[model samples]
Target: MVQILLSLSIFFTSAAQAAEKAGMPQLDPTTWFPQVFWLLITFGFLYLIVEKIVFPRLSDSIEQRNDHVSDNIDEANSIKDQAEKKYQEYLSLISNSKKEAQDLINANKQSLQSNFDNKKKEIDKKLEEKMKEVSKEIDDFKKSAAGKIGSISTEVAKELVKTVSKIDTNNASASSIVEEVSKKYLKGLN
Candidate 1:
C-alpha cells in the first residue's frame, strides 16, 4: 500500500510539472480525454465501494439501532401500563380500608351509646328503690310516735294545773280535763 501511494504521488507530480511546461494543460483539449477517463475511474471505484460495502453496513447498523430503540420504547410503555394498573389497585384498597375503618368506628360508637343507655336505666332503677325504702321508714316512724305524743301532752297539762292552783286535784277529773285540753291543742295545730 505504501509503494502504491508513493508511485501515485510521483506520477501526479510529473503530470503537474509537464502540464506547467505545456502552458496550463488542464485547459488544453488534448489532455481532457485522459483527465475525464481518470475521473470516471475514481468515481466508479468510490461508487462501487459505497454501494457494496459502506452503504449496506451503515444502513444495517442504522436499522439495528432503530429496532433496539423501538423495543425499549415498547418495554417502557408496558411497564407504564402495569404501574398504572397497580396504582389503581392500591387506590381501591385504600378506599376499601377507609370504608371498613369508618364502619368499625360507627359500630363502636353505637355500642358505647347502647351501653351508656343501659347503665343509665340501671342507675335510675336503683335510685327509685332507695327513695321508696326511705319513704316507708318515715311512715313507720310517724306511726310509732303517735301514742308517745299524746302521753307527753297529758303529763305537761297536769304539771301546769298543779303550778297554777297550788292545790291537789282529783286524778280522774284532772285526767278528763287534760284530755279535753289536748284535743283543743291538736285541733288548733291542724
Candidate 2:
C-alpha cells in the first residue's frame, strides 16, 4: 500500500513536469525511469495473477478432460471385446446347430431308406406269390377246359356227321377224328 502511494505520487510529479516541458512523457528522458518502474510493476502484477489464479485452473481442467476421455475409451474397448466374444459364441452355437441338424437329417434318411427297402422286399415277395398262384390257377383251368373240349368235340362230331352225311357217328370214331384234327391244327399254329 505504501509502495502504491509512493509510485502514484512520483507519477503525478512526472506528469506535471512533462506538462511544463510541453512534450510526450514517454519521450522525456527524465520521466523514463518512473515510466519504466510502473511498467515493471504492472507486468509483475499481471504475471502473478496469471500464475496464481489462471494457470492452475487451466491445467486442472485439461487433466480432468483427459481423464474423462481415457475412461470413456477404456469402457468402449471393454464393450468391443465383449461384443466380439459374444459374436464368437453365436458362431459356435450356429455351427453346432447346423451339425446337429445335418446329423439328424442323415439319421432320418437312413431310417427311411431302411424302411423303404424292407417294404419293397415285402411287396416283391407278395407279387411273386401272387404270380405263382395265378399261374397254378391258369394251369388248372386249362386242364379242365381241355377235358370238356374233348367231350364237346365228340358230341359235335356226331351231330355234324348226322347233318352233313345223313349218318350218325360213334363216340370212339368221333374222338379219334377230333384228336387227329387238333394235332394238325396245333402243328400248323406252331
Candidate 3:
C-alpha cells in the first residue's frame, strides 16, 4: 500500500512538472521579487494588526476579567473571614455572659440563703423571748391566786374558831394568836 501511494505521488508530481514546463511562462526575478515583496508587506501588515491591535485587546480583556474574578474571590474570602471572626467573638461574648449569669445566680442564692438563715435566727430569738414572757406571766398569775386563797382560808378558820369558842370574837388575845398563825403559814409558803 505504501509503495502504491508513493508511486501515485511521484507520477502526479512528474505530470505537474511536465505541465509547468510546457505551458507556464518564465517569471523574471525583477518582476517576481516585487510581487513577493508586496505579498510579504501585506502579510506583515495583517500580522501586525492581529498581533499588536486585535490580539492585545483580546488579551487585555481576558486579563481584566481574570483580575476581576480574582478580586471578587479575595473580597469573598475577606468577608468570610470577618464573619468567622464575628461569630467567634459572639460565641466568646455569650460564654462570658453565661459565666456572669451563673455567677450572679450563685451570688443571689448565697445571699438568699444568708437572709433566710438570719431570719430563722431572728425568729428563734423572738420565740425564746415570748416563751420567757409567757412563763413570767403564768408565775405572776399563780402567785396572785395563791395569795387570795391563803387570805380566804385564814378568814374562814378565824370565824370557825370564834364561833366554836363562843368567847368574845374580837378579843385582843384571840386576834393576836390568829395573826401569829397566819404569819407562820404565809412564811412556810414563801
Predicted structure with the largest lDDT when compared to the true one: 2
Q: Quick one: best TM-score, which candidate? A: 2
Q: Is candidate 1 or candidate 2 better by TM-score?
A: 2
Error of 1 at 16 (Å): 19
Candidate 1 lDDT (Cα, whole model)? 0.86
Clashing pairs in 1: none
Per-candidate alpha-carbon RMSD to the true structure: 9.2, 10.6, 9.5
Write out the backbone clash pairs for model 2.
none
lDDT of 1 by residue, 28-116 (tens): 89888988999999999999999999999999999999999999999999999999999999999999999999999999999999999
Compare candidates 2 and 3 on lDDT and give the better one.
2
The models' CA-based lDDT, in order, is 0.86, 0.91, 0.85
Query: Residue 119 of model 3: what lDDT?
Result: 100
**Arranged by TM-score, best first:** 2, 1, 3
TM per model?
A: 0.67, 0.69, 0.51
1-190 per-residue lDDT for model 2 (tens digits): 9999999999999989978887655677998888889999999999999999999999999999999999999999999999999999999999999999999999999999999999999999999999999999998997787677877988898999989998877889999988888768767966
Residue by residue across 71-187, what tens digits does model 3's lDDT show? 999999999999999999999999999999999999999999999999999999999999999999999987886666656655666678768886545545555666677669779
